[model samples]
Target chain A: MTQSPVVRLQDVTKKIGGRTIIDRISLEVYPGEVFGFLGPNGSGKTTTIRMMVGLMSITSGDILIGGHSIRKEFPQAIRQVGAIVENPELYRYLTGYQNLVHFARMAPGISRSRIDEVVRLVGMESRIHDKVKRYSLGMRQRLGVAQAVLHRPRLLVLDEPTNGLDPAGIRELRDYLRKLAREEGTAVFVSSHLLSEMELMCDRVAILQKGRVVDIRAVRRDSESSEAAPDDVWFDVERPEEALRVLDGLGKGRIEDGRLAVTADRKTVAEINRKLVEAGFSVYGIRVKTKTLEDQFLEVTRGESVG
Target chain B: MADFLRLLQNENMKIYRRVGTWVMYAFIIGIPLVMSLAIISVTPEDPPSNWLFMFIASNILASLIAIFTVVKAADAVAGEFSQGTIKLLLIRPWRRSSILLSKFLAMLLFGLALTAAAFTVTLVVGTAFFGYTASPEDMFSEMGRKNPWGYMLLWYLYQFISAVAVASFAFMMSAAFRSGGLTIGLSIFILLAGGLITNLLSLLDKPIVKYTLFPHLQLTSYLDGGPGPLPQYPMTLGFSLAVLGVHFAVFVAVAWLAFGRRDVA
Candidate 1:
């Protein structure tokens, strides 16, 4: 929290042909965090990202990267970031290695060894010399990731990055993004409709509807920094009724599904567990029931078509 | 400027890596060789001088070169849109104007390399088959040009300018419309129609013919200090060049405006 935000959008608006596509959206993304962007179809997630990366014009206000305005200082603002606006549309005629080399020439100071490093990192070594036309959708996705991180950018922006990835490839992309953020302090801004995928990969999420941000909140309730937050924790034990009564004073515990469900923070819940054990109550299992992102998404979207 | 070169390198890689581009270059080099050899075989006893063959072969090759150049220019900007690669290309640190300029320069370089290849083959084969004569300068000295080599050089320069004008027109269309086929078709139409309009307009005595682009399209005629290819106009070479220059500026202005202001979706 001490460091400045890596990306900040100030009342950014986009109007195309007299219709507002994005209406005064504002937020900030800091270093070493994965910020998820979510919206139904035609909700303007792609338009907002287009403006942030300097692909589209900002009708009002501004998008800043590393404190430089994208409108006035595009080269300066965009220089610190790497982005893929939609699909990773690369040249299909050239080899994957040639495609990487072609893009590496556009940015400054990207060495040959660095291209090799990214190729290896993305697991494209064996097919790096093959033509991209021969690559599968998932292989193209991996190559897309390789190119986006080739310059070691401070901020990485991806739109629908997991569109065609298999389960294993998607998992690899998630881990790679986390590693990039953790080790390189890169702030990742990603948009995907897979609520479950975003729930697993993102640190925090901003839900967008009708060209507006409706909510921004943490993805996981068990984050230590939010230890004071009362999460819905369930405990399965030998005596659900007796255990519920033992912790009744500390929290509002009730028996549901023949288990004790309590709304309490980790600290107070730990205290309740100690008291239960001291009273000869055996605790068999403990789990934090995270509210599914799909539920929250549908709740915020008001059950509208996810288009 | 160094950064600009790297962008140019990227554009060049995209251009030359295509198999179709190589085929275009092949026609450029191959057609001239075959034509020169045909001339030698048909009239082995007394073929025309090298300068004469050079002049005849150049006229045919220039039209082909212009078509090829315009095709590449049309693809320079519109191809990115068709391939959906413009988004990835534009998100870099460089300005939009810089990216466009790199593509423009690459198209021109491709044209230059093709023209140079055709010129070398035509001249080399033309001289070997027809045999060079020392007194050919006298034959071509009708319009105050005494040096045959210099005269041919001026012809090539003027031909290149015409090609530039055609490519610029094609480039403007593609940049503004984001449709390569439309630009290519329209440019080739204009190129072929210019010749027909020139012949048709010469028959008319109207003063409007003086300002028509068809008269000025063949810029090489002004090398003789005459009234140019279409003598009905009697306009100076400077006036013709000025017209082309103004048109060039207009094409570039429209291209820059459309490309710089467009919001790529």
Candidate 2:
């Protein structure tokens, strides 16, 4: 909590052709944390990332990487950050090792050993010598990760890195990103439409809708639960129909697998349980199922097509 | 400075790593060697061969270098955009200008390498075929310049300038367009037809052709202190240089501005 943020975007805005692509969104990503950026198809996730990495100009506000402003001091600010905007965008003709070496030359103090270390870190030792054109999408993605981390950047930003990856590749990338955040103490910022991946990989997520930061939620709910609804409470009882009858005032109840499932807060669940017990029903068990990020995202960005 | 060198190295790596680049190099060297061999084989037993003729023959090879330079420059920026590698370059610590300048320098070096290769081959083969002696009657003084070797160097200087101009135009197009094929195709068209268009315009006698880039690109005509290739052309060497300089500046400015503002989506 005390560590200073590795990246800070203060009221960043981008407008193109009289229409705002991103509107005054501000957030910070700390070191050693995986921050997820989630939005629908045209919700400005990539636009914000492009602005952060200096690929696109910010119409207003600024992004600071390691305390250097991207607009004012682009070279210095970008030196502390490594990013792949959309795809890996590598030189396909060159070998994967050559691609890494080519990028490493642009960064200061990146030695041969460091390149080797990153190559090993991404588990691309065997195929690093092969041409990238010959690499599979997964291999290219791993090579991308290796290239992005070669300089040990303070902040690593990847936009849709897992777009074309298989499930195994996505898992590998998630594991590697976590390792980078934990072992290298690098701040990892990734944007994805895959809510499950974001749930598994990120520590905190910021949801964007229509160029605005709609909500920033922690992936783990234990630290903060106020924003979370109580849960869908399911009760296993001797008499499901009796339990449902006792829960008439609550939300709609469904009986499945000899248990009653009802959407309720903690107090309502307790009240239902007490009523069921008083009404001659054996309340064997009660389970509260917390909502996943997918459920919350659908609820938050309701009525908008995911695109 | 060190960073610029690294950028140049990266550009060079990308350039030379392609199989097509090697093929272009081979063509530049191979075509001249074959032509000189043909000339050597067809000489009659009477007339003495002149080595300067080989240099003259090699002078035509400059256009080949120019064409190659045009294609390389056309691919330098636009090709990266097409292949999506520009994002990798754009995200680096170097400025956008640095990345572009490095690519330009790499293309320049490529043109120079081709020119150098052709020059070496012509000189070596010309000496071997003609015994390295200049016949007084055919001392290349009729080419309107004495000292054939010095004249050849002057010819190369002018040719290099023209090649730079062509490549610069192509580089500008490369920055402006996302399609490498479009950039290369349009540049080759311009390079091939540009001079003819200027000559056609010159016949109109409207004085507008004097300011166009094509006529001044024949810079070698002014090397001999003569009236240049087009006697009807109304510009002096200084005027031609100024015009070419203006075009070069414009080409570079267009490239810089386009590249700086382009959204690398």
Candidate 3:
């Protein structure tokens, strides 16, 4: 928590033609983590990402990248950031390698070997010589990542990066992004409407609705158990009634489909598991029924249509 | 400064790497040859003088060159928007003004290259058909200037200036609009009809006609040692260039304003 953030949005707002497209929203993305902006279509996810990367100007507030204000110091702030605003719209007339070379010339200190290294990292070396017009959407996406990372930016931002990828390609991108954050310590910021994808890819997520940050929280429970509130935990045990009795006064416990489900924090669940095991009961497994972002969204929107 | 050159390299790569761009260049080289060959077949025994042929061929080639460069200039920025690559192009470390300047400079370079190619082809074809009977010392051109070579060079220079002015106008249109087709069509329409508009507007004889862009679009008209394209107007090459300069400055200003401040979305 003490680490300085790589990107910070402080009450950033955007007004386009007298309409507030992005309201005042504040958040920070620290290094060595994957932050997500989760919202539905037209909920200002792309607007926020555009402001973060300087594609759109902020109206009322400021965004800082690597301690440089994006408004006052654009070239310096953008120097530390690499971003794909919506889709990876590259030059389709040029070959993939030419595209990489084109982007490499925009920033300083990107050698030919660095371009090759990024191509290999994205697994695009085989088709990197082909013209981008002949490439499939997934291939273009990989080349897009290669160009974005060629400069070795401190912050990498991808807005809805999984739009056209198949299942396997999406999984590969998720793994690569996590590795990018872990090994290189690059702060990866992604914006997506797909909750399952964000669940798998991001370490922390900020839920935006109507251009406002509704909630921001850590996604992984293990590394952030201190902030874990009470969630539904389903316990698999040998006894049906004894497990219920063990969790009698702790919280509301119910046996659902031959399994004991309790609404309790992680600590209470661990205590209940230990108590059931000590009372001559075999605890087979403990599953924390992590609430999906979709469920939270549904709760927040009150069953309204998200799309 | 070196980094700015690298940015220009990126712009040049985008400009020249396309198949269509090479096709345009081929047309620039081919048009004069085809015209010369047709002229030879039409008048086999009685070919025109070298200077006459050069003027005829250059008039046609130069107009074609202007149109070609204008088309390219129209695509300079609007093509990026059509292909959705402007987002990527603008997100780099450079400022928006620098990006627009690099693109405009590349278009100017393109205009200059096509002008040079057309000049070389016209001279070669003109000399191939008719011998260089008149030396550089001979009295030359419709104006009968003593230095024929200097007169021809000045004519082409004026032609190049006009083409660049029109092309820069197209560049401005490209930056301000999102549709490549509209930019190209509108620019060519104005170019092909500019002569007619200038003639019609000169009848007014008002002082404003001297200031309008149409009166100055045909800079090569001054090569005959005339005061202006419209003899009644009493305009000089210096005066015509000043008018064109004002127009060019306005186009560049509008392009920078539109490209610099607009949101990429």
Candidate 4:
């Protein structure tokens, strides 16, 4: 999109005692984008988010938000950022509105209207005045988002935003986050173990394993080749044996329900189709099954366990 | 300066929002009024001096205020960590030192407010029963410097200093521990047992007891010209203040070091 980066992490590394928790990692999050951070359990995802917001100290390297360095100029850097680490830990004694007001008072120049605007933006207008202890987990999550965006932060960071949400709540959060990025142009940096949600929500995702960024990939349509690898393509032909014979060069063909299923890429599938037509076989239909995000995630992190 | 004020305001709001805070305020004010009523009912003709009445009532209420201060101070930082609100609190524009200082100042303000409330109630109840009469002799039995206003001021000052010591100790514990309940419990134990331990040590007639923090907390005895808690071991007000001052600084320093370096996970 050629937009200036809203958040930048440069060669960040963290060491605890004698063990390194986060190895050198560098990335950027631009405005109007939802960037996903994916990692296995104890892969330093939370630690990295903590360092970004200055909740935990960075052993080395720097994080810049809107060109302000977090290590050297924390107040200036953190001023443009809002975050909720782990869970939204709010005061149960106060109302959701009160919680927002309390946080707004800390951030400079946040007017009452801004508070109201964020409330409406998060769709918490109906129950904003209710005490937080009475609100559900989903409602609290929404309130957390409202508080984080009260000052219209340039970047919003959330660690496991959909931890305890139900399916409907997850969908609502996903849609709201997308809308937030599109409408407000706030760069969102979210970390989660839910690969499906990350696939649907994020424009790009960085996968980490053993405290290292193993891969950075574009998600959804931005991905150059969703079918670059071979997939199972099924063909319903007049003679399954003939189709199997025609596709035998590509991969092993298995017959199921009067159809020949063969593993091949798009090019190979097209070549097989052309070969079948030339061989005088009636090919009624050919369907290519695409791989889901879960399948890809499993393949990428084949040996590692995901929390 | 505005940022500091906002941090203080946020801390104040967090404190005042708790039902426990209001209940504490009520207890501080209510207990004094209730005591005055009982005393008035018992003594029909005795004309107690307003100053004396307030002095006696506040002296008793000061201990209660100390307990409340301990509770408030103990919850200042540790409660935030336990409730997970520290994450939100620390992410603001203010520095951790500023946030910690604000929470400490708010707890002090709460202690001051409770002390003021107790003093005001004592004044009101004493005036209602005995009229506005300042009897220096009735209040101060020690024969030196019979200025009633100065004496009463020193009494309140002593009570406030004691409150600060207890609050600082609790605040240090708060910064050191994550569990608010444990902090409060340990503080209460120290508040009561620490005094007893000092007194027990005083009975040993050792010269080292003079340096302990508990003995120095009794700055009131110096003002009253009394022999003090340990009659054999005497201390000047300056010496006592120096000792308490050292303890206060140590407590605050420990709290700052612990809070500044905490990982905040």
Candidate 5:
């Protein structure tokens, strides 16, 4: 059985100034999963996220967060979400600790201990006492994440959290977010135009183009038996020429520079193994390398006009 | 309610920490000091300085406070949008109206504090230099023998109302315009040019123009007991209060609606 979704949108549409920003897009985000929203600039990724969090009103259809309609019960629905859209803004004049304290007040039942805990969680305990104006860009981004999760929200929505970070900062953020999902069981919905970054961070991805979701795919998960199998499989072998001979007549196969590439299913792999053994060819390795999410996303969303 | 109060506290901290707050306080203190020096330099043979002049001059300085307060309030909301802070704010699981109200209340408190400082300084300096030994009754007699205490209270209240009116207008413009300069510039223009526009309209003999908020921006008109530049109309005080009230209500309503529906990308 499928897991229940923490956030669900059905045929949602958004129009601004007589132009459609998002058009009849449907998506579901399950619990404790990092759902990457991938798109190019002006592809309505931000608009869709805003609709899910009730920041932007939906022109048609409905959005439900944990079984609550966002339009009818926005306060309740939005209460479960914590988002940092675009740039993270704090009171520039106030110290980092003071900024957190101020935002903590707005969060119901957020104690002082929790504020300190979030500061520590983001690795900002040392500089949290310093004014935000004095903070570096990386430090500010950490503080932004600290503020977003202060309420222990079920769903954390971030738009391009790594936009301006250095490579080290990006790696730190990626690891921290993974730990958050693994330990805290919080679902993440992140939007970014960087395809490779999404591939590293997301368990599943939804590709949006021209105000519509073009495709949704689960990364690192085997395909279901009911669905069509993947069309391509890559294998690294010791004897590429020998493996190619064994894989012949098992549909189109090629041996390219010690790698055996085949377009076949799992059963075909078993047959290839049996044939290789009979032919006295040692198959050192046979692994089906999955397609990179970037290739799939680009293939799906190419040549689309976006707002 | 607790959440609302927390938001208000956050807004208070934001405004209080700004350099602008200190600048406003300095202006409040500077106004009375300049007036004291001016009064002291004059010959005693000229009309002796009295509490009435002190009151009128202090009230006029309050107008500057009102303008400063309005500029601050305008930036309170619009600046958030331009700086990309609105996104962080909207995702906080609170209603948009609550945030707006918290900022409004903070600005109001700041305005009142500035006005009170100016009033207190003028009173102390006027009392020390002029040696006007007069109770509330004597002060009222000096101002054409009117109800001095009542008029003083009314004047302060009117100043508060005018400040709030200006704040609301600035906030409305801030919501409509993304740039902070545009919001503050338009608000100042409206406040400074309202009288001039009304005067021009009067030359055209448009009786209905008198009812607008322009002619009533002067809080001291209540102390004067009669209209000076504009013709006296029935329920003059009520009409002035009503005009300010309507202006405030309309601006706040528009701000809330516009902000609630805005697409914050």
Candidate 6:
């Protein structure tokens, strides 16, 4: 079976003011998946996203959205992609509804009802009648999101959507975005510096460092036991030499600081313990170390220098 | 076509919503009213010749409207870039040329509307206070019994054309300089300083000074006879039009090329 990605960038490079902002970055976001783009500040996450949506031209590379080449069919590519780069500026004098209506007109075939639907979806229905200048920062962000998704784009790209939001507002935005991707089956590519938010919200994540994709991994679940479970079974044995022999036999274990760390299923740990006991090695204790997303992210992105 | 209309509607909405626009309108009308009242209270007989009155009124109104036009159009593209809204618009399924053209047309319309409003008020007030009658024949007549309908037509066209020329220059400055204030200041400086530079240069009695854009920007002067000691020449009119055309074309070309290649980050 072949699955087409909602958004894809191939060897994208962007140079600005004699510096490479995005350096040969390639990424793919699958349909109906929330792909988190996590990076430090100035890591080219926003630049990459902007190029994907045709907001900024690529210095040297190609971006495809919904099977359309961004350079050749920018409007078609952009038609399927909804994006908010940095702060989403709105017409301050117009009401929230009016702003949505104005943007909606830009998207051909979008009706007034669609505008109302998006306003309600973003939970700005109550305040949609008020002028945008009266809106608080969170309210404006919500309206920005509403304007982005009004045309029901297949791929939604948001750059730091929760930047200035309060805790409550951030939570609300997170929940709203989660529900949006889940219910609408839209592919969401969200770039943020907040790793914890990505861990909580994204189905999968691509960690970027200095315009390079350092790692791509699925979100770990605490309750589900699987082969990919990041729990390292650490065994502290009496004889480090014998432990190494036994761990070598296990084929997936590494000895570090007199302990045998093995990547194995929960049931296999007991077999390894029995083998260590059979080999005349005293096993002091066995502990399962759960790996956090931050650990994985740090491991992937560490030592990468910015271009 | 629909998109163009929508853009025009949005532009009009922006003009109406801005506080600056209203302030400019009030100033345009207010100055003419004050001037009319002052002239009426001071002058006992006919206030002045129609040509003199027109010259004074056109100069004042055009100067004010031109300044406002520079301010408004200077920010047309630059403001969007600063406000971070250009990305949203550019990401839409629209061509860059269309967007730029829409803005240019909107600014042109804005200048024309402002001029019309000021002219209407000034004409009414001047007629009421000065009692200067302007008949169809007077409109057609020129100095030394020369038929100036062609000149007047050229003058009216220049009302929009010169404003467009100023707008184009402002746009170029806007594209080059990201700051709205700097772009506006530079545009106004050029608009006013060009005349000063030309006047200073004319003291040398150089022939090339006639070719400068500043010497012929006065579209109204053509309607009156001509400017300075220079006699009316078909070459002068042609030269002025050509210079302005080139300035306008160069401004737009540079703006488009710079804008098209710019990084919107």
| lDDT of candidate 4 over A1-307, digit per residue (tens) | 7988999999999999989999999999999999999988788899999999998888998999999999888999999998989889899999999999999999889999999998988788889999999999988898888888888899999999998889998998899888889999989999999888899899999998878888888786535666667778898788787667866666557787767888887888888888888989988998876677677777788857776
- What DockQ, between 0 and 1, does each candidate earn? 0.69, 0.78, 0.76, 0.82, 0.63, 0.49
Candidate 6: the clashing residue pairs are: none
Model 1 residue pairs with clashes = A40-A307, A41-A307
- Tens digits of lDDT, candidate 6, A1-307: 0578988889899888888877888878887788899888888888887788776788898998988999888778889988898887887877888777777767788888888788777888799999888999889899889888888899999998888899988888888778878898888989888878888778889888888887888996665556544457788788666677766667388877756788777667888888889988888998887777877777787744422
lDDT accuracy of residue A169 in candidate 5:
91
lDDT of each: 0.87, 0.84, 0.85, 0.85, 0.78, 0.77
In angstroms, give how far residue A247 of model 1 lies from its true place.
Answer: 14
Report the alpha-carbon TM-score of model 2 versus the true structure. 0.91
**Residue B251 miss distance in model 4 (angstroms):** 1.5
Estimated TM-score for each candidate: 0.88, 0.91, 0.91, 0.91, 0.87, 0.86
What docking class should model 4 receive? high
- Docking band of candidate 1: medium
Share of reference contacts kept by candidate 2 = 0.81
Candidate with top lDDT is: 1
Report fnat in order of the candidates: 0.87, 0.81, 0.83, 0.84, 0.73, 0.52
User: How big a share of the true inter-chain contacts is recovered in candidate 1?
Assistant: 0.87
Candidate 4 — which pairs collide?
none
Residue B232 lDDT (model 2): 81
In angstroms, the error of model 6 at A246 is 14
Chain A TM value for model 2: 0.86
Model 1 Cα displacement at B226 (Å)?
Answer: 3.1
A127-156 per-residue lDDT for model 2 (tens digits): 889999999888888888888888879999
Model 6 lDDT per residue over B1-265, tens place: 9877886776667667778789999998888778766776788565664434554676688878888988888878888877777877777776777777777778888888887786667666666665654342334345412433344335556665677787788988887675788999888887788778777877777777766667666655555545432343334556677888887889889988877766677
Of the two candidates 3 and 4, the one with more favorable DockQ, higher being better, is: 4
lDDT of 1 by residue, A1-307 (tens): 7999999999998888899989999999999999999988889999999998988999999999999999999989988888887888888999999989988998889999999999999998999999999999899888888888988889999999999899998999999999999999999999988899999899999999989999998886435547678888898778888887777557788888878888889987788789889989888877887779999999999998875
